[model samples]
Target: MKNTRIKNIIFDLGDVILNIDVPVASQSFAELSGREQSEILAIFNENEIFRQFETGSMDEAGFRNFIREILEFDDLSDEAIDTAWNSLLLDLPPERVELLKNLGTQYRLFLLSNTSSIHITQVNKILEASTGVKKLQDLFETVFLSYEMGVMKPDPLIYQKVLAQAGIKADETLFLDDNYDNIQAAAKLGIEVIHVQKPTTILEYLKDYAV
Candidate 1:
């Protein structure tokens, strides 16, 4: 049975609902810049530009320029950079879409993602193409994006802001995320959390509630 006390659900975008393959994007960037995939992946993990971009401290043009500079390919076009950056995004499974549709009818559903604008646009496209859902926002009550919010998960302020803006109490909400740090952070704030591990999905975790 569903938890009667839980009034809202906050969902992490990557891995929880949308499938993403980081190494694919790393390979794409490597191919474009003639760099090793490992090097590209390392840059993504360590680069300040990536964090800045996700936090809204950097604009698209600035982020593109930074990518070109880091990749040492000054001639890379905007389309090429965006394509490589968005390559990490995969399809939103139809089953997950249906789960969201069913859950939204019961509890208040919200999407919280530590993602970039370039990726979000591509994700929406993938969601539309895969499930006939026009936009991701249509599946949730509200979408909280790192790039748009200027804050990312693992930060208490982001969760606090979501709770404040949604007018929901932390103890009355449930959060599901693939990242352990994010799960811990939300749990610390008294919001119940489920670590949506690999090979198991929100569909598997909340199958009972979907009906």
Candidate 2:
């Protein structure tokens, strides 16, 4: 049976829908800063620096500076660092945007992403430049960016914030994210969560409850 219990659909921007080459970013950092990718990623994954950056405690420049300091790469210029940082960006599929638009005819679609200013700026540029897809801004009813909102996923507060903003019961919401922890976090609050892997396209998932 269709999960008619679902009323709101929340999406994670990176990896879930939009393809992100996280390894590209890590490789760039390693190449520029002379640190091993594992070491740099260890720092990033351990410190939740990305989460802090997303939650607005650190601006793009500040985050870059912090990383530079951490790696002790005094030789790298700011622009170089920015370039390395942004190398993770990849194209968003036009088909997914169209699917989301179709789903919006029924469900309350929202984007809740743990993204910072640097990444978002790049994303907006890509959306504007895309030829086939509806602009990312136009595909959803609301886009709740973590940097702008000062909250990030896997943190329960962000989920509560999205639920309150959408004015829906947690049981009525379905959250799609690539991160297991983020999915589990939302599940804790009663959201029907999907941990997307591959082949199981979101369109297939939406067909169940889509009107």
The candidate scoring highest on TM-score is 1
TM-score of each: 0.96, 0.88
Residue pairs clashing, model 1: none
Off by over 4 Å in 2: 45-47, 131-135, 209-211
What's the C-alpha lDDT at position 166 in model 1? 97
Candidate 1 lDDT (Cα, 0 to 1): 0.90
lDDT of 2 by residue, 21-65 (tens): 888988898988777999889878887777788889988778978
lDDT of 1 by residue, 69-183 (tens): 8888899999999998898888788999999989989899999999998888899899989999989899999999999999998999999999999999999999999999999
Question: What's the C-alpha lDDT at position 103 in model 2?
Answer: 84
- Tell me how far candidate 2 lies from the true structure as C-alpha RMSD in angstroms: 2.2
Query: Candidate 1's error at 60, in angstroms?
Result: 1.1
Question: Could you tell me the lDDT of residue 182 within candidate 2?
Answer: 92
